[model samples]
Target chain A: MAEDTNSKEYWRWTESNWRDPDIDWKAGEIISVGIDVGSVSSQAVILVDGKLYAYSNMRTGSDSPKSAENAMDWALEGTGMTQDDIHYVVGTGYGRVNVPFAKRAITEIACHARGANFMYGPTIKTVLDMGGQDCKAIRVDQKGKVVAFLMNDKCAAGTGRGMEVFANLLGIHITEVGEMSLRVEEEPPMVSSTCVVFAKSEASGLLREGWPKEKVLAAYCLAMAHRVVDLLERLGVEEDFAITGGIGKNVGVVSRIEKELGIKALKPTLDTQIAGALGGALFARALEQKGRKSK
Target chain B: MKANYGYKDGSGEFFITLDTDRCTACGDCVEACPYGVLEVVDDPVDPLSDVQVAVVTEAERKKIKYTCGPCKPVVDRPPLPCMTACPEDVIAHSW
Candidate 1:
C-alpha cells in the first residue's frame, strides 16, 4: 500500500486505475482465471492481457470446488476460450482450494477489496459482499488494500440463500421477487425475528393470515435489507460504499439500502455477483506485473 | 491400550490420511475430529479442504491431536475408523 504516491495526480492515476495497457492479449497472451466458489453461487472471471472479456455466475450447486469448476467452464464457453489458454488459475471464496486444478488459493476478503478498488477507484473504503452464507463489511485503502474487515459468517439471515428460502415457500423464482417487491401497496407485515428459522415461521403465519403475496414480498425484503444494513453499520461503513456478490443485482434491495443509509452505493456494469471473481482476475494481473518489475 | 503403530515422515508429522478425493465431503470428519479442528463449509456437495476453508477446531484441546494412540496411525497409505465409538465419527484407536 505504501508503494503509491500521496499526491493528487497519484490518486487520479492510482493502482485501481491501472489496466493492462495491452487490453487485448496477443492471440496467445496468457489468460488468468479467478474462480469464486461462494456458498449460494459461483462465478468465473477471465482477464486476457488486461481487458475483462468473460464472466459467468451460476448457482454454486452443492459443492464449492465442483461448482467453481462448472462456473469456470461456463465462462470459458461463453468467450470461446478453453482451459488451455488459461495460463494460471486462482480459487477464492469458500471453495478457493476446491478447484483442484487451480495454482493458488486466496481469501475472499482480499479478492473483493481488489475488485472494488479496481471498479470504483482506490477511494472506495468499504464494501458489502452479500453472498450466499455470509455478509461482510470490508474497509480498504487507495491501493485496494484491505485495512479492516468483519463478517457475519454464522448467519444466513441477510444473504441470497435467506431470500431463496422464502422464495421457495412462495413458489416464486428468487430472481423475480425483487421486482415483485416494488408492487407492494401497504406497509406489509413486520418481520422482527432475526433468526431465519423464526423468520420462516413468521412467514408461515403471514401466509395463514392471508397476507397477499405483494405485501409478503415487501416484508421479506425489508427484513432481509435490515439485516444487511445492521452489518454495514458494524463495520463503520463510510462513503463510497460498494455492494458486490450475486445479491448486488437486486435493485429493490439496493434502492432500499440507498434510501435507508442516505448514501449511494456504487456498482459496475458487469454482473455485480461476479465482483469477487473480477477482483480475483485483477489481482492476478497485479501479481504478474509485479513479477515483471522485479526482474 | 495406547501404542505406536507407524513411523513419522520427513517433516516428522504423522496423520491418518483419508482419501479426500474418494471421500465425499459428508462432513463426518468435522464431527469426528476429537480436537475439534474441522467444520463443514457451506454447500458441502463438493468440499474444498483448503480457504476460511479450514480452522482450528475448538474442543477439549483446540489443537489437532497428532498421536492419539489406538486411533490415527501413519502408514504407507491411509487408515479407516476402528471399532471405537467417537460419537462424532472422529478417529479413535481403542481396541
Candidate 2:
C-alpha cells in the first residue's frame, strides 16, 4: 500500500450518522428522547411514537451535562424539535445521573439489552457492549430484562481506549486500524502484556525489532478479542448474540470473537453504538404509556 | 437511606456495611453484584431477626478493598451497580 499523507483525517470512523431523514416527526403523537453519556462518547436518540426518528453520536467532553446537551442538540440540529417538544427523556450510561433534563436515569446495562432487543429483534439473548473505557457482558430474557451481567472498566486492556493508543502510535486514523490490521497475510504473535501501559511499550519494542505496523496492530486486536471473550464466557454466552458500542464496527475484533466462540453475532441494520441511548428512548416511551394508564 | 461497614487502610478506605433495619434480603444486590462481593446469609449483624439478609461473601470479607477496586467510581461518578440496584435504599461503599 502506498503511504497516505492525510494524517489528520484517518483517526476516527466516518460511519456515524446524525439523523434518519425518512421519519416525519410531525406525524407522531409522542416524542421521547434518550441521552447516553458514556466515558468516551455520548449519544442522543429520539423516538417518535416508538420508531426511531433522529440520533447523534459524538465524543464526550469533560462535563457530563454539557456532553449530554451537545449530543441532543446535534441530533435535533435540522429537525426543528427543541427540548420542550419531546414528551419524556431518559438518561443512561456512566454519566446518566448528570443529565440535567432527564426525568429518570437507567443503568447502561439495562439500556443496552433493551436497545439490542429493538435493533437486533427480540431473539437477542446476550449482548456484549464494548464502550470506550469499559466493557459489559449482559444476559437478557426474551423481554430484554437483564438477567445477568458483568462489567470491566478499571482496565483499558480490552476497551476502545486501548485500541486508540495503537492508532496513535501507528499514526493511522482509529477508523483505519481495523482494516489495516486485517490486511496482514499471516496472523502475528499476540502481545503478551494485558495492561495498557505495558502493551504500549510492548508494541514499541516490536516496532524496534522490525515488525511492521500492521502485524503489531493485529497482535493488539487479537489480545483485545481474547480478553473480551473471557468476560463473555463468565456471564455465559447465549444466542442470538449481538455486540454494541463503537467497537462493534471493527470487523477485526468482531470476526475474531465470532470465530473463537463458534457463534456469529446478530448483525444490526442500524448503528450499534446507539443501543444504549435507543433503549433509553424506548424506556421513555414505555414510561409515558404507563403514566397514562395509571391516570 | 445508606449504611456503611469496613475500615480505613494506608491504600484507601474500604467498608461494606448493610443497614439491617432497612434490609429486606430481596437479593437484588446479589444479582447485580458482578464481583461476588455480596451474598444472602442469615442475619449475623442483627440478632433480633431470623430473616435471611445480604452480607459480604466470606471470600470477599477480608479482600473487599481489592475486589471492589475495579468498579470503584471516582468521586464524580454515579453510585455502584449493586447499590443502585437495591430497591430497599441500602448498600453503600466507602473509598
lDDT of 1 by residue, A162-281 (tens): 777777778776666778887876656557777778888888888899987767778878877776776566447788888886567676677777777888998565566777777777
Query: In order, what lDDT does every prediction score?
Result: 0.63, 0.80
The parts of candidate 1 lying over 4 Å away from their true place are A1-24, A27-30, A78-80, A291-295, B1-95
Each model's TM-score for chain A is 0.85, 0.94
TM-score of each model, paired residue for residue: 0.68, 0.77
Q: What is the lDDT of residue A275 in candidate 1?
A: 73
lDDT of 2 by residue, B23-69 (tens): 78899999998888888876532222357768777566556777887
TM accuracy, model 1: 0.68
Q: Judged by lDDT against the true structure, how good is candidate 2?
A: 0.80
